[model samples]
Target: MYDPKIFKTYDIRGIYPDQLDEDVAYKVGRAVVEFLKADTLILGRDMRLSGEKLSGALAQGIVDGGADVIDIGMVSTPLVYFAIADYGHEGGIMVSASHNPPKYNGFKICRERAIPISGETGLLEIKHLVEKGKFEKKPSGQLIRTDVLDDYVNKILSLIDKKRWKDAKRLKIVADFGNGMGAKTLSNIFNTLGVKMLAIYSEPDGSFPNHEPNPLKEENLKTLKKLVLKEKADFGVALDGDADRVGFVDEKGETVTGDIITALLSKEILKDNPGAKIIYDLRSSWATAEEIQKAGGIPIEYKVGHALIKEKMRKEGAVFAGELSMHFYFRDFYGVENSDLAILKIAELVLAEKKPLSELGRPIKRYFHAEEINFEIEDKEGKIKEIEEKYGALQNAKVSHLDGLKVEFSDWWFSLRASNTEPLLRLTLEAKTKELMEEKKKEMISLIQG
Candidate 1:
């Protein structure tokens, strides 16, 4: 039996054995085969404890449904995406709970060319098919094992110019994988690039011995921050469970927010592809858009989510897209999110600038931002409307309900949205001054919760 709650806006995710088990995995396997009408598929899993069992059961179901499987064992999520496109498979599935606790596990599924299956785009249908469970029986298809590690590394490495390699070698970097699957590919990339790297929690451990794999949380980034300072490294990098999302700590051991990194990288990319369109989620800091425009690139704000961002990237012919949640997508990468590419782009930028990461980001860190805060509110929609009505009357204020209620003023903006997973209302506010941000935050909180 599968829990309906696991069918999220973008992927399938839930606690293992209880909410998600081999039975559910098998059903999802069959559902994907039928829903995508796939003849062949690529499959991979992270270092979670239940990965083997889940992938085994899922593969059995897929093969039983008469679709061949190219099993690329024990890889990061992006590697699975790479395998699907690189090998010309019809679709793929990755068994990873992505930044969740070790006891939890789930799958990220995609059709040909790494197109995601989400709630509005086939995830619900797959869920319905699984619930129905009346699958057609057919002769099992082949399950072949393949290795994509070297090819994946080489392909990403090719994106970097050889001249930058020498400068990269001069840099001392530190990486904290949080005992996830990042070390598998990252170690290879570092070695091949001849860069000096201090790897922390580099070993793949499903138990997450050091800390949680999530780097977005300040607590999770503490270790990386310390190591970067202690080693005096050029910068520090952190990746989530499947290594698709990345986080950074500057040489000063300061944790950089996702949008700041976006602004920095936008400057680098825009230098090469001038006037290119870049996508930033509405929740991101105004610095992202300001930096993009200053760098001669067109900035477009889109609703958040990997599926939506990728769709916008393709539609606008955007060179890149960055979200406050740490997801970065690239047009060159078949419109897929790739933390590895973000790393390389940072490396190139560092080489070109010849400045410390912290110094490089100072200009873009002009604005004060309130970290995303959530309030447990029963009337989510009504509260959002109330705040909208109160603020919408302000002169020169712009309101957008794209993904939530966002009000923009000359010096500040705030977004209020209902959480998709819980009975909570989320708020994020930013301003030109810390005092303004504090004042508005207090006002917003009182209005939202009171």
Candidate 2:
């Protein structure tokens, strides 16, 4: 019997072959086909050792449910989304673990517009179908292989003006693929752009021999930072396991957060399309919204989750949206998020003007943010209720429960929410000064721990 708990708030992920196996994947394929009534679907996978087997099994189920499959084998999450949108397919699925440890793997599914499938949207139905185990078997459908690497590369290149790439002087960049699927697609794209690239861990190794693929962890980005400074490269780029999320290091070896990158890109994008709508997750710094407003664009704040953001983007016709976790979305690019495409735009902005990244980031104001703190506590619901009653009466703060408990004050704000996957409370706070942020963080921690 399949468990519905594995169907999470964001995407389907768990310990592979145990919590999620080929049987579960097969059922999920059938559910998706039935739900979307998709006649044609696109499929792709990451570099995880189990991805190949899972993709095959899932494809079997998708075909068995009477849908034709376009297998764009061994690609990233964004690339899978790209193939779905570029080829005008009805839907797509990516077999990936996406920054999780080796024991984990799962799928990211999307309908047209590359819209994500989440629990509140359609993941619950998919889970219910799997648990019911009552799928009507149909005749085996056909599977076709279409290597869309060239088409994908061309589409990305088309986003940037050809004159920019042709007239660019010799530039050096250090790209750290981290043994993920980024190497599979980025190599050809970079070569076509004539970039002098120093690539590391470009091989597709699911074991992740060099370092874990998550660049958000400070330890994972050490090698990339060193390479950037050692080579005096123009910049450094890092991609998560599935390559949908990106991390960047400046020429000076300083790590740049996604908020800062989004701020930079917002200026460029708004220059072309004034008064366009831009979206950012609540976890991001206020500077993102301020920058968007300063650029004459409307800024919409949404809860943290790609599915929610994409839905909001489609409704508002947002030109661009970014998350603090390095996911960047675009309305023009079939409304699907793509880190690879974001990288290309950043490269163009850098080369268009001969300014270093640190200089480019100078305009945006910075703040001290406490790392997201998680606590395993009993009475998840009761504790939140108590905290809300205690702090809900504060005169200087405005509290809201969008995703979790968010309290906004004049110069600072903090949010405490329960983790969907665990018995834990996640706290995120930001303030004008490090001392203030530290004091606020300690006070909140005491209240929750008490």
lDDT of 1 at 153: 94
**Per-residue C-alpha lDDT of model 2 across residues 339-392, encoded as one tens digit per residue:** 777887788888887788878876664788787788998887787888888878
- Specify the poorest-scoring 10-residue window by lDDT in model 1: 159-168
Which predicted model would earn the best TM-score? 1
> What's the lDDT for all of these models?
0.90, 0.85
Q: Which residue pairs collide, candidate 2? A: none
Instruction: Give candidate 1 regions above 4 Å deviation.
Output: none
Backbone clash tally for model 2?
0
lDDT of 1 by residue, 1-450 (tens): 568888888899999998989999999999999999989999999999999999999999999999999999999988998999877888999999998889999999999999888898899999999999999988899999999999999888876677766766788889989888888788898888888989989888999988999988899888788888888899999999999999988899998889998998899888779999999988899889999999999999988789889888878999999988888887777789888889888877888889889899998889999999999988899999899899998899999999889999999999999876556788999999999999999999988877
TM-score for each of the candidates: 0.98, 0.95
Question: Best-fitting candidate, measured by lDDT?
Answer: 1
Clashing pairs in 1: none
The TM-score between candidate 1 and the true structure equals 0.98
lDDT of 2: 0.85
lDDT of 1 at 131: 94
**lDDT minimum window of 10 residues, candidate 2:** 162-171
